[model samples]
Target: MQQIDIDNHHLNFQLELQYARARQRQRRRNIILIVFAIMSIFYVFIQPNQYGNKQNQIQYSQTNGTNGAINITETNSTLLQIQKHFEILEKLLISQFQGKWTDTQLTSNELAEANFYKTSYQNRFQIQLHLKLIEGQFLEDYYNQFSFYLNSSQLVLPLEDNNFVFENVRGSYRRSSVYENDQSSLEIFANLTMRLNNINMDSDTQDDIGIELDVRYTLDSETFSFNCNLNIINIDSKAIIYSTIVSVLGVIQFISCLKLMKDFINENRMASQFSLIIFVFLMIYDGYLGIVHFFLALQSEYFLTPAFLELVLFFFLELKLAKHIWQERFINLQDNLNLRRELYRFHLKFYLLAIVVVLLLYYLIYYNVFLIAMNLYLLPQIIHVAYKGQYVEFDKIFVFGLLSTRLFIPIYYRGCPYNILHAQVSYLTVTIIILLFAAQVVLYYYQCKIGPRFFLPKWLRPKSHEYFIEQPIDGECAICISQLTEMPTESQLDNKFIAKIISQNQNKLMETPCGHHFHSICLTKWMNVKLNCPTCRSVLPPLI
Candidate 1:
């Protein structure tokens, strides 16, 4: 046998060794990103604006311990409380949407206050070229406030019937385990049928029908919001355009999710969970769309067709993911947990909150930075991938789907010449936004191919896991029992064939920390069943 030129072994696999355990750190980073994503999403969902960090306690009539029951008087009292809540909610809604015309007269005190505000602003803010930038900012607010105050008093929107006919009100009661007797919370919900008179504003007559109020209240916080959805009255082109755009985006998003789901159909445990969570997120979005369309239908008779059709489609559309999750959990049961029913319930709960958000923040339809923010959401993921120094199986479909979904609404309103709102957007701004999106996508693509840290200097990258394994030392292979000291002739050892084997087997050979060497494929097969070396029985680190 010809002695192998082990010293001169310049095979690609021999040049650098990548340990599987190091990949685990990359996976751990991925996990942290997932958790951060979840928590950020949840925070947005709850939107708990902690009011001055103050907690108010409310007393509820105690449930009888003997029977776990409530008193009739207590129930009636709760109804009275809900009625009072509705009255308060009605007042709050009137303040937000009730726009005042320039012709409207201000109260004597209000006029006096406006005059004082103007005089104070003029005295404080002399327009000099001085650099009090932060202080100068307040001048704009003051001027705008004075101007608005002079332009209006209250619009004085009255109720349709002037009575609290609360059609529905339900509440969930939870007592704090730590302070069960003293601190309890009541999350109350109410549905009321009501309409405000005279909603026309700025010479733009918008005939709105009755509004649907979904009030959320916490007795402990003494906080409540009308959180109502105002029905669109007349069938208009804008409504049609907006609905169509959203529906089309949903189709794109759903299709991409299905494509991603395809990657999860295998026996990979982590992949299954990630895919399921993504599917659940889609369900939540579907629920939000359902709310939006439902409101659209309520606002216009012409919109009823699109609205109902969407719902019908959604009914069937959910089946695809539902069936996938079901099969994964029951038919082809794997150890990776898939709580299908729980996830469905989770989506439902989020869907309910989404409806509340849509109602309360209908201004988001026209946008308030939220739409633009969506396009930049990938920044966090991009940063995470770079920090992890790994390519974690991202795909083009999902990336572009997210980009398209986020950009569609904004692009339609800003880019379309014949937009329903007839708003003129700067063509340059739209172009810049598109270019920015393109740049981000390109950077991400580059990262996926040549590691996430491609932008970072090469020396900073982790090289500890990598070792020059093809040292000029003679050794014997434990698994193949081949002469590690021999190098065959070009015809016998074919460079192309050697490279193919290395690629297929991750690495042609692996070096254990305890000075053991084996064929990479052979060691991998062993690690799947046990974590000890075949020859040394030394504890082997697990692969990522």
Candidate 2:
């Protein structure tokens, strides 16, 4: 009678083990299916921002004219529109001039007017400039005052200084170096003597004539020498470079977010949706920013307003992303309701304070404050992780990349005050992150084992039975009715385990605090989803 009972028990155990394995397989399939569905939905709904931007451009052009100029109404005069264009051109010229020139750089708001034209060969470039009057009101005739032209040729000019006398203007140009391509720099110094016929050349009467001007530029001296360190990169080439990098990052992060979404859905984790939403917003903003850069490169005046708006949006989104990330750490611990509530309450207060800061302060100050807050919030987590000395999570690596640069750069800049080293360090850190993220994307795509393994220290490598809870007595799992350590050969179950399942206890099973033993895979999945013991529905203790 005892042998018969034992045989029946073994048969039932075998059936239960098969069922548990089958359930895990089904769950995996369901997860994959859900992920696919979500991806499809995003594809359908979240069209790339560029497409809409293009459509808007087309509609705008059609509405305005074939020439793509804005139609001015009585309220919006042509002069007002012209003034707006001049303002944008002034900013661009000032920025480019200050960045490239070495001599007699434009003082703040000193560039009165600027325009550029490309020759038929496309290699020849001409830039026109007019300096702002020091005294007297800017008049409609201001456009006619002190016009100067800078010319560059694709043909490399001789590296010698020479004096040339044109019909109306006499000048000396020294071509020290020529810009060969987008990657190269151009160094040239030029001085010109302008015969200002429109201006009353008399020094005392210059203001009366509506012209305040210094007409002579010297090649040998700094008078009228607009410092020349011109590295002329085409806007299109710059746009391509920036757009390519941003596009690559956007694609990789989009994939990462999709993976995260899948995990959240599979585990039925709703608490982290706020973070996901912020992440999505950031991705959208990044896409729009890239589009803005491309349009700006094309010299589209229409996108200028949008570009500033995008910058402000980026600042806000970055702050929100940090906030959501901080909130998610605690809320993700589904078992700890009290802790989650406290964290949520804290986050609410922080958010209100942040809003006040955002409203009261400028974006630069807000950016610095956001960085400081992020570092402060992440410091405790970093310390905890270091103290625990456990496996380094994949998300932690991502967060580290995001926060580390922000944390150190601001501190360095604060101490040093606008040092060139700050810029170099920022660039170096960004380049490293880009390379690492690219590598991460490729490794993740290939399912490389080394991706996660290399990030963790040897001591932190998981041990056998690390996740398996030993129970006082053995029984079937309520989630998956599988017998534990009661078999003719425990090793026989090894082949049935899924890829994620670690058969750590010599093919033995896991147990919960409630005393029910289960297949390690079954209990782990159940605990991950609900944080409860399967049989008695008791909240499980938090794992390290």
Candidate 3:
């Protein structure tokens, strides 16, 4: 009953050990699952804001008006009248330069003179026109000229009761007027005519001509104010191409945030999930900035905000994730003081400090500095650790991952002239992915391969024993196990029969490499081959 109880106890001990190991495995798996769930939740809840409905709000205020409606009326009508007159001047200049005939024919010298006049007029007119219209300066010189044209009936000025009108040489007309009451203001009427010029009239002839007039009146004074402008609307399609590229890259950046989370998982699941949450929030903020950019392209404000935010967030998350992964693999506070001492003595602090300095330099100056320093500092450590048989799997993976990253460097840094923003973001994303992948590979290898190799050197070698077996008179010597020997000790003689059998059977005696005697020869052989002192396989050297 006692024996059976002891056997059952031993069986239970083995089972308990197995259960503990299984539990540890389960715990690790759970940690991974928790991280994955967190990341998935972040993506689901935060990703939609990046791509859904966008809003644009525009607010404008006009000067020289009591009512908001009055402001719009005055501003739009004045701008339109000026635009019409500018168009007329431009057509007249083009016709005169090309010697196109209206009812009045011009002599060649007159045409040449008009051409010269047109060039000079356009040059000076554009400069003054920009100042007057854009700078909001309706100078007296400009207004008097419009008044002269209207007074001569070459151009008819509209009614001064807040109405504005423009008639083109093609007989098309645009009329706009505003009305105000004691309570509010309203647009009394607005009409515009657009005409298609006859191409067959003269292919080379310039036909469109008109006068631009700007008018203002003080309601209390009832005095008319006017300014003349030469309007030139030069529309180019190239600006649209640049805006479209920016918009497309913004969309791509939002999508890349989700991909970044996946890369985080491949790095270190637990810490990566935390980083993913932060990045998701950053993506939402960036998306908001993108929306602002789209709506307010004309303002050019808030342009740098998103880029600044992105750069900050990217750097922060990258460092945090790297630290997390590295800590898991290399840092162990609970390790023996002596072991830590040895590692420190090996200049681990120097390496770590170098890493920190490089990272800081990257943030302060240039990213390539970090890359160069990391390569220079880390490659030697990897080789050293690998040669020590530490974290073999991790070392192999790290080597490969680093190689891949180096290969990707050019790709990351290649700035596509047409897609500058996209290229920069892509470079950062790729860099983060490579770093995370390398870190993970190192962690996994350390956990499995390197950790197991950490055993005491003494346990791996052999020890010596002192006992020796006597040989039987009629049987064999234990050393040769073939030649018979007569030597026998008193105890051996007392158990001579058993001793003789043991000796003849080649079973007992041992000898150390130093010529010391022992009872177990096989054990001595094992000790010698393992580099322990069979009598001492120490630096004292083997004894013959």
Candidate 4:
């Protein structure tokens, strides 16, 4: 019987070892499957949505030389290319028009004047210039002088045809003159004006806009160069008024973002602080674009690099912020650890894809999809808040407000025409948000200064004496079983004074209706978990 029992025990031990090994193998297989699943999802989603060939490709080629020749070739949107062609056409027409003005001048005189009839349809402009160029710096000096002139220049278009206008036109000029390489080139830069539309006018057009252009013919080369950086600006008076309002609102929004960032920092919310910092940067970039749009002559393309950087930064911030919200709200969900690990992997892939998108697609509108995706990721948190009927975090409120500013208001202006309704809706939304923010600030201050009782209405305020007592029945608290009269010897106050406060004001003692007393802090902590008196197990109202 003993030998049979030993053999049975050996069999049982071998079976148990086999079962343990099988379980370990199963766990490893599950881990492998999870990793494979995460990678597969990443490849499927992230790989397919790469920037396609539809974007404008900018390439640079340099030849081997001391003064390397740089060539830029692009396969871009035909529409944009056509737009550039039209701009070149307008420039050619303007140059021809100015040549017409030059023809009427005396070619022999060092100083001559050309006067043209002011066609009723078009503006009659005079060209005059005083030129002095130093030796060995003809090209650069002439370009610099002309660039300065274009900065102050403005285009006035006829009411009928407003296309092909350049305002705040400024840039370096490309010179193809015989005098370009000369020791000195005395060239006077001149402005050109022409009537592009209604060349065949009925009964002679009336209003006239005049320009004065001065040019000096150089001896080294009998040629000159003229060009302006073309950026369209067609803001009407109504649009200007609306833009002013939008600017004011943008300032307010920036202020609000900064305040929230400060709060996040103070509260030690690192993730939130990082997100708000990005928001502040984005607002500042928008402000810069706004200035370039409405007040400056710089081309929108000039700001593309910074704008692209901002877009990439924004996507990164959104990813981080989404992950932060998810972890905070989804801690109770099953498989949370695996979900968080996968989330990091997904976000890493997304960050790479976002950089690619911003580089390939310069349009800011493309990034709107990212914002939508971020919000979708946060939908669970939104739903949870809705179910609980609680206030959202202030960061969320600020984010939505900023998004509205971008989506509803034409904050960048960009010369796109907008109706009065756009202005009205933007103004209303921003005003309401500002008011709400102000109220929240006030409430937060009130909460900090006053106690928790102030959170409830006067009628709902619980009578403290019913649950609190001036003295403990025993020397120790019934809940913690610690001496209630124990005081810290912090050298700032007398022990007697501390004892007097505890005795007279029921300082640290709280008594339940069941006639048992506990430390106020201990009882409150206990009630938070189980809304009942610890000593008697009696039901009580939940702590607010």
- Report lDDT (CA) for all predictions: 0.42, 0.37, 0.33, 0.37
Model 3 segments more than 4 A misplaced: 1-18, 21-31, 34-38, 41-46, 50-366, 376-378, 381-411, 414-544
The top-ranked prediction according to TM-score is 1
Model 2 weakest 10-residue run by lDDT: 57-66
- The residue ranges of model 4 lying beyond 4 angstroms of the native Cα positions read 1-194, 197-299, 305-309, 312-315, 325-440, 447-506, 509-542
Residue 459 C-alpha lDDT in model 2: 88
lDDT leaderboard ranking: 1, 2, 4, 3
- After superposition, which runs of candidate 1 have C-alpha atoms over 4 Å from their true positions? 1-236, 266-286, 301-368, 392-394, 414-432, 458-464, 471-508, 512-544
Which candidate model has the greater TM-score, 3 or 4? 4
State the lDDT of candidate 4 residue by residue for 1-544, as single tens digits: 9999999999899799979986896686567546644644454345431112224322211121212222224235533443332332322221111111222233221111112211111132212221122112212122122321221123323212423333322222323222344233233323333234323222222122223343332224454432222221222444456556555555555555555545444643333112222433353345344433322212112222333323332333332344454443333445747876766865576556546544433454223233233222222333332222222233444545444454333322211213322111123233444454445444433432343234557675544435555654556666667777753222232224233334444354676777776776566545533345676666565333
Residue-pair clashes per candidate, as listed?
A: 4, 3, 11, 9
State the displacement of the C-alpha of residue 485, model 4, in Å, after optimal TM-score superposition. Answer: 6.1
lDDT tens digits by residue: candidate 3, 1-544 = 9999999999899799879986896686567546644644444345432211223211111221212222123456755564444433333322221111111121111110112012122122220111111111221111011111110111234423222342221111112111211133222211112122322222323333223334343333343332332222211122244344444453344344334434546642233112222223233333333343333332222333333333333334333344453343333344557545754643464356546544554363224334433333233444333223222223332234223323332333332212212112133434554565466446444533433233335455234233344442343434433433333332332223333433553454544445544434333333322323334333212211
Per-residue lDDT of 58 in model 2: 18
Worst window of 10 by summed lDDT in candidate 1:
126-135
